[model samples]
Target: MAQNSYRRPAALLAYEVSWEDLDGAETEVSPPKLVEQVDVPATDQLELMNALWDAVTFDAPWVPETSEPLRLVGHEGAKSTHYELVLVGPSVAGGSSPIMTDPRFAGEHDAWDDIALDKSVDLFLDQILVPLVEVYGLGNMAQLDAARLSKMRERVRLIYDKHLMGLGVYLKAGPTGYVQGMKFVLQEMVENSAYRLDMANMIRDALGESAQNKVSIDALEARLTARASATAILAVVQAVLVGTDVGKVMYDLSASWPEVAWSAVSAPALFALSPSEGVVTRDESSVKFTVLPKGATSGNYRYRWTTTGDYGLLSDLLLPDAKVLDTREREVWYFHNSPANIQDTDRDNVSVEVFEVPEGATSIPAGAKPIARMAALVRGDTRVIDPRLEVNSGATPADMYDSGETYPCVEMLLRFPRDPKAYGYVVSIVGMGGVGDPRNPNYHFRTGNGNVDYRMDNKIGVNVSDYRGTCAWYNGFFGGDPADWPATEPDEIMGSGGYDASNETMLLMLFSAVDYDDDEDLGAEADLWKEWARGATFEVFPLYPEDAR
Candidate 1:
């Protein structure tokens, strides 16, 4: 099958606050802030002209319409007008980063024609551009020499074309979609380097030497910085919306798993070993589904190869051999060898059923260890299903030390080799169910009015001390006493109520830890679960990091 390519946005609308009427007076807007009646090529204008000339050929639609208006009017019949102006482009919605955020294109016009592709492209462009300009605003032009300035303009042009134009397509497509857009942006940067430099210098000169009260260069710097940060945030948000390639990689790997190589047999009858459910079968291949019963609440379950393959697939892409067994009843059992090409004597119709295995009998092979272990108990797999990071409202808990606003949590998954003697994987559950204090219930710990009294100073308690040259922050002795802590192990460090490892997953979440009252924190728990599911997908194989090997 041909790989899915990036989709473009249909309409890119740039909004320029043309003019605003405050009370009864009119005001003008300036560069980076223009105030005037904004204009598009105009649908009616374009259509009437096109129809007259039979020039309309493409399905390109006009940009979206807005009630906000090109010019803002004061209440009733205000004699004066104040305006903020903007320019938007059709491709801005789905175009590359620079085009998306290009100051020149104000996306205010409505679409004359409806093209679904155009809409997507518009959305893509809109999602990305607004932020880029906000964040990287034509940085310091004073330092640019003539040649370098020229180069910078070229760079800007390249950014406009590639990153901006390619907005509609997926970012993961890499150089394919946005690469060209990036090039365009660089071209724009090169073409307009001198202009942008002159503009910046003029603004600096004007603002820097302004009277004590006028907008100062310092103020502009602050404002520009804020804008840049906002732009960066928007870019990050759009990248996330475009979706990551990680899940796709997981699904593809799962489809090629070894289980498909083995003939599909009737679901085996599970025997109770140590009062645990255990089902056995004579089949093996790339991917294997061992449905361990998650107790009685979940009915006769099926842990088959998942179409999405979000979890419960072998880690190593390589094939493995052996009989298939179901562990529905949480029992353990030894693998029973089958005669080569043997058929069962019983003539009864074979049906797939829950395989429960007693825990003791199904001990993992001590001598022949697989690099990783994968499992998904239907009900027990609650961790796998609910609270997918993609759909969740809560991104991350709000940092309490700062304003009560929340930080977006980044999701990551990692797979590690299964250990026979020790628990190989550890998941840190934050917010709500795990770490949050229920009494206060602060999602990001923003105490409102009367809620102030219920607040706690800090969530986690820690003792800071120095050992030799290293500063050791101790939380607790989980699994053992504090004295038994593995001081030399760099991976293990103080976390939440105890020490935690620096495994790929752990490190990802740990770095995201922020201060918020448990009650205020919203997304950490979901983040933890989603991270685990992602980690599970990776664990489907015995794949190891390069350093580990």
Candidate 2:
């Protein structure tokens, strides 16, 4: 034919050789068999056969770079990428078919592109080959132990002695050579081997138990990573409101109320209706209440209280959870003026109103005590203080009618458009001078009492300056006339300098101009409070990141 082009070698087919028959005698005649030749297109047939033999016997592939093991074709002339093989069928004696199965082609073949030959070989050897070898070795050991238990025990003693030497507890046989001395060592060695087997069994059982428990551990991890509950959000609100140092409540729901559901009810609600609505009657040990307006169409109401108790005890109102209204920051307004007037200047005679009722009661009961009312009234007859007067537009001077003295007090009202999807908060603040009030512990030392003066860094109650930007600013008077106030702008003031978003109780800020002396006075100190009342403003808006939530 052509020049021997198959340079790579081909492996000898198992069918190429004859084996012993059932009689245990080697057969001399050639058997009827199918043989394959290597398909590598080598010009030399002998060289191709040699390469195939080496690949199978020594585990080296024909192409070392590609690392693909050679495969045999049925015929000598079968073509491959760079080789060809021949398929031949030689007749044996008595015309029998092939007897032995081919073990060479038993394992799975690798895919063309992603195969890493070395790694695949390593995996096959470790996962399959080593296990198979260990199984065969264990079988042989079992047979040996069955036949020679006494000898195996002796072997274990020897192994124990070797190990003992490594552990620095070896006992060598002395020249006296007492056989009794070695009996204890043999017993210890045998026990050690038994202990090893027990330990291995224990380890295997632990692994199996861990595998069984894996499902539960995975589920718990998933639950921990899921979205937090509504109770968590409520806790965040409490933390912002009532902790100690900064005074925002902090408690983990997992530890504090583990049994509570996410949507469970909070503390009970206490109510206080306008007084003119009805009258309250006394019940035995409990308060019975009712409301009566003066006229049906007049909208005027009056409340009569008959509950017999010390009014001071009513300070901690008791009512159920359902009675409280969901007003967001509007709740601040109800408590603002009801408890006590925060704007009073007199230190010693400061007065506050305390109420006592059921924990969840919605309306204020008649006959309930309203104790401790102190009035250091700021303007008195000099300036008229309209409590609920609404401010719509423009800079207008509120009339101050005290002893014929008239000073102008400017008021501002802000209204925000309602958002259906977003939660909103409104913050109101009054300005103060650089020196904080000596009486208040929450004072910040940095800012001045001006419309524009603001505080910077703030944390908790540690320093004076820090409190400026925190809660509602009601410390002292700001300095500015309405004309001095920015006319073109919304007259809104930034709280970062003193009043901050974190301490904002409510969204609305109500401002008033007050005369320092009984007469409508215009001294420089009076000007300061007057200016503050006239021109001061606060910012109000939503707090959290809407998109993120």
Candidate 3:
């Protein structure tokens, strides 16, 4: 059991545009832009790259992709050519803040690859502007100095702004996913002193001639979401795309949030790089399931334990895969190999990889068909799953905001079995029905989804909001009860959503929230997905109606 590290984007393809082409007007500057692409070395920006990768994979909370109100915005082929690249946003060339307009019209090659965190600044200095010096007949310089640096900064500042200057030219808007890629850049730039906002400058620019007058609430309020505001935010994005210090983009944008003109400030909680359908694959030797230890501290830790699904002489055999309810520090099991695929229970009856079926038996051992599984397109994380009922823990109701509750929880992605040959069963709901989720029950809860806290029988003493700022998500049973939720009742934890027939079995993702109060059942999430995948492993002795009493 080795630590699961985050993977960075394998490469970067940079595209530069001429000053004329970028601005949408004619200019004499030739060789003004050349696509000087380079592969970003993973080691260069380990932290930044991992974070960005997390965002794209949906493992991170903020960076999410949105589908807008489906409508065509004329033809984009005429605007973006192979040689040209545009910095897209809400209102491209429209009035006011073109940079913040809309991004619907942007073609594939139109975006500037500002994906480089601090490395972007280097790209600007070394590749973008440096090449221009020799080509423009400008005097060649040996090294960069204070004066030269300032000049270069100023020179490219305009170029960068114009890159996204007025792309809002065809701003067709949407409800969310508006600020599509800004969050990744923000996540990387936030802590660094380099990417800071200049509030004083923004104030000066906004007040204009009225700067001398005592600042009035009206003035501040007006500028909050006005064109100038968008300008300031986009300016920061431009600067950061070039490696400038944290600019006023995020700060300015926050003041006017829920109305930032475009883009979702946050995305639903999901495993970074997780698939949208919750589809997963697990054979015997190597399992490729992905889990996000929601509340666990950030670190490189190993997942060590045997899964009952591995065909072992262990307890909890009824479970397709159940990690021995264990923890670290005290006597623990194996810290052996890198986290890989789960052992396939289906094959156990015939030929298996990690686990073996007994001889003379055409199918699995008695009282077992295969592990029951369900498909799900589950997302979001839960915070602290307080194992204790501390008076203060329940003091705070619950911060069931959009995706914030997913913080500090565990993410498990598993498959629900659907094979009539091995075991026939349907996954259904229990506990908190659609009336509402115990944590954040609302009419919108079932707008397009359903979940049940099957093993949530101990609801009497548990507070809605645990000791932590958030409440435990009782939407699943991976962290189900052992005494109350006996191993026999896999059906008790089955989801209400039936197995999808058109496609193969889908994944059953369980984000079992962890508790700051205890660590005994800490390793549950890892253990669950590692073992479960067979269609009907867990079953009632009389699985087939009158087969047993």
Candidate 4:
């Protein structure tokens, strides 16, 4: 079963590895990460190279940070609030998660609360509290025992709550404000949630996970969210934040605690999507695509637009089949009520023989004088129509009206299939959590997937959404209500300073199933022009309701 890719390389080529760490230096320098690469003579044998790779990998050592005692660099509280709990010890991924370094600014679209709370709790438990407890001998005491840990967790809960209430500040700021300053770092941590367990192990090792020591969670709670152990850690975080000597603080807190036993915390299983036991085949439209149910737990799973008036957008619908669903925006058609030359004079009749509009969609009138014409957004003086432009066999472009100015077309149709949902046109997916009673009319929603909301807004001036939150604008299928659009022509908020959720814009091309020759199987194909696709299997996650987390 081993293929050519698995075969040993024939050459003796050198290999390099890298990492990024914030070291206290005048400036970042060579081998900049806390860890340095291991050097070995080149070898033609794969096994030998892999062995060297393993040795230098997971168990490798790292350089210590250049600075000690992270400080409140900005956001001064009359004087420097040197953070108490310093969890900087062993590097899991080249550096320890630190509370006392640097300041951050949230991105225009970043949900700072979402970023900070999740990270703070995770780090508080795995990186900070767990280690202190293990070193002090205050846990449930048995790595293999579960019931005892559960009982001790009650006291731990009270401990965390009491301190959180007493300190009234988190990391020198109110819990919310303090974390806003760490937005960038916090976002990185959220992106690497898989690092949570690794961080726990790092904490365990830092506390001496040797023949004499073992560590486990006290109450795992539901995986990642509201961990009782983590919550408990919050109560004692103040000790770490303020302690001039962490070892002494650990010793003192354990001595004050009356618990007679030590217990390990349980690990919680993460809630993740899985593949369903079903088959997927292509849908027959002019294009080819396949859809199968990605299994979801029997709970809330619904992903929709977070911003009002912002439905997803697709750029093109002309291809008979598409190997990849193209979100890059391109104009399918543009016509002027008072016509002017949009093209450099080759054809004068706009083609519309293949334009598909939904039966009830208002973008295009139900009945109008049909044109044997099509249009494309073209460049330069070229009369050549790029075949990506969906034009019928006899279709051609229309000439400019004698007025020499192209007036607006009152009706513009985005090529949408009859049933968008049936064909699965929704783009991004986000897991949501609900607040308050679900039966109440005023119930609210929260994003709780612990993953960054996958958005289509990346590239500028393209068919897909631009979500970098940079306030850049493009002329694609604008998802806002037509009534809300300015009375003037398409412009970037010409009369309006801005709109809400300035972070995103999307254009989705919905291609319905085209009939195929194969009755037992469905298939479609489209020339995703430019050969930009790398043949990666595209996956869209199912969204969950806010109440379901």
In terms of lDDT, the best-performing candidate is 1
**Candidate 3 residue lDDT tens string, 413-434:** 2334344442333333322223
Candidate 2 positional error at 342, Å: 22
Candidate 1 lDDT over 53-162, as tens digits, reads: 11222121322211222222222333333322222222212233332243533332122122323433432333233222322343321221222222333444444454
What are the models' TM-scores? 0.20, 0.15, 0.20, 0.17
Ranking by lDDT: 1, 3, 2, 4
Off by over 4 Å in 3: 1-215, 221-244, 247-382, 388-489, 492-549
Q: How many residue-pair clashes does candidate 3 contain?
A: 56
Off by over 4 Å in 4: 1-118, 137-155, 166-274, 277-549
Per-residue CA lDDT of model 4 for 1-549, tens digit only, reads 001111111111111112122341222223211111111111111111221212222112210111111111221121111112111111112221222222221121133233333333333332234324432233322131222222333433444453333222343243343323223222322244443444333333333224215345332212222322533444333433343233332233223211111111111111211100111111101111111111222221111101011111111455322222222111222112222332221111111222224443334344532211221111112122222222111101112123222221111001222222221233332222222323111111122331222323222222342221122223335546433322222222211111113322222221111111111111111111101111211233323344235
Model 2 alpha-carbon miss at residue 269, Å? 26
> What is every candidate's alpha-carbon RMSD to the true fold?
25.3, 39.4, 23.1, 27.2
**What RMSD value applies to candidate 3?**
23.1
Worst 10 residues of 3 by lDDT: 388-397
Compose the digit string of candidate 2's lDDT tens values, residues 1-549.
111112221121212233343344543223323342222111111122221211221111211111122232222222211111221111111221122122322221121111222222222221222112112112111111112222333443444344333321111121111112222322332345543343222222222233323324333223322313444323432332232111100111011210101111111112221111111111111111111111122221222222112121121132222212221111111111112322211111112233444555545565655421111111101122222222221111211122322222222222233333433333444443334544211222224443332222222211111112111222212333322321111112223222223434222222222322222222223323333333334444444446446
> Over all chains combined, what TM-score does candidate 4 have?
0.17
Provide the clashing-pair count of each candidate structure: 146, 91, 56, 62
lDDT of each: 0.27, 0.24, 0.26, 0.23
